[model samples]
Structures are given as C-alpha cells and as structure tokens.
Target: MTLLSTLNDDMKQAMKAKEKDVLQVIRMIKASLQNEQIKLGRELTEEEDLTILAREMKQRRDSLAEFEKAHRDDLVEKVKIEIAIVERYLPAQLTEDEIRQIVLQAIEQTNATSSQSFGPVMGLVMPKVKGKADGALVNAVVKELLNNL
Candidate 1:
C-alpha cells in the first residue's frame, strides 16, 4: 500500500482499538495532508507526503525542546510520543557519515571549492537527500566539507 493508504488503515485500527493518542496523531497528520492537498489542488505524491511528515516531525522536535527548557516533563513526554509517531512515516534518516559522503560528492559534482558555492551545492544536494535527511544537518555537513576544501 502507499504511505497514505497505510496511514488511513492505521487510523481505522487506532479508532477500533480506542488508542486516543495514536488516533490524535494520525488525525493531525491527515489534516495536514488534506490541507496540503487543498493548497496544491491535487493529491500528494509520496515525495510530497514525506515532506509534510518531515515538517510535522520538525515541529514536534522544536516543541519538545521548548517543553524541556520549561521543565514541563509532562509536555515533553507527549511531544516525544508525537515525534515518534511522525517519524514512523518518514524515510529512514541518513546518518551523519552518510550525509557527509553525499555532501562531498555534491561538492565534487558542483566543483564547489569554497563557501561561495553554498547555494549551488545545496541546490544539487538537497534534492538527493530530501526526506531522507534533515536540512540543518545536511547544511552543516556541506559547510564543513566546503570549509575543509
């Protein structure tokens, strides 16, 4: 099944099982997907769905950080659970070493010798890494590789 269909199936299961937290998270994802579909006037491709999932995951992570800083362990735990749910829908994340290797390859392909080539290098690399890696992490790896060149 497609990712979207899997989500729909899981939502039905969650409802049947009376899994409130899981149901809530699934509803949030569905709402976001629906909103994006409306905005674009088309059903989302797998790539677009992954992008939305990543964005939701990022939002949860950011909320987790804030909750941590506020010492609200209860909220932190909730956000963590939400993050876990969101992560289940994302592509397997690329490790730092893997990202670095990809960045190196992008630099080579772009013939980017310095930071001045950041834009072109990112343009080339982001598409390859999208939905499989976090943007901030990829940017750091690219900068490190370019600086070392």
Candidate 2:
C-alpha cells in the first residue's frame, strides 16, 4: 500500500482501538495531506504525499524544540509522541556519514569549487536527499565541504 493508504488504515485502527493520542496525530497528518491536495488541485502522487509527511514531521520537530525551551515537559512529551507518529510515514533517515558522502558527490558532480556553486549543488542534491535527510544537516555538510574546497 502507498504511505497515504497506510496512514489512513492506521488512523482507522486507532479510532477503533480508542487510542486518543495516535488518532489525534493521524488526524493532523490527514488534514495536512488534504490541504496540500486542495492547494495543488489534484491528487497527490506518492512523492508529493511523502513531501507533505516530511513537512509535518518538521513542524513537530520545531514544536518539540519550543516546548523544550519553554520548560514544558508535558507538552514536550506530547510533541514527541506526535513526532513518533509522523515519522512512521517518513522514508528512512540518512546518517551523517552517508549525508557527508552524498554532499561530496554532489560537489564533485557539479564541479563546485566554491560557495558560489552552492545553489546549483544543492539543487542537484536536495531532490535526491529530501525526505531521507534533514535539510539543516545537509546544508551544514555542503558548507563544510565547499568551504574546504
């Protein structure tokens, strides 16, 4: 099944099981996906759905950080739960070493010798890495690699 379908199924199961936290998280994800579909005015392809899922995951991460800084452990725990739920739909994350290797490959492929070439390198790299790698992590790797070149 597609990731969206899997999410729908899990949502139904959660509802049936009366799992409040899981149900709420799934509902939020569904709303996000639906909003994207409406905005695009077409059915979402699997890749588009994955992109939406990734975006939702990013929001949860941001919320988690804010809750932590605010010293709201209860909210932090809730966001963590939501984050876990959202992550179930994401592609497997790339490790730091793997991301470093990919960044190096992108630089080589683009013949990027300076920070001036960062955009082109990123354009070529982001599509390949999106959903699997964190954008900030990838940016850091690119900066480090380009700076030393």
Which one wins on lDDT? 1
lDDT of 2 by residue, 1-149 (tens): 86667878998999899999999988888888888889999889988987888888888898888999999999999999888888888889999999988888889899998999999989988988889987888999898889999
TM-score of each: 0.95, 0.95
In model 2, pairs of residues that clash are none
Model 1 C-alpha lDDT per residue in residues 39-145, reported as the tens digit of each score: 99998998898888888888888898899999999999999898888888888899999998888888889999889999999998898888899898998888888
Which 10 consecutive positions of candidate 1 have the poorest summed lDDT?
1-10
Q: After superposing candidate 2, which stretches have Cα over 4 Å from the reference? A: none
Q: What TM-score does candidate 2 reach? A: 0.95
Question: Runs in model 1 with CA error above 4 Å?
Answer: none
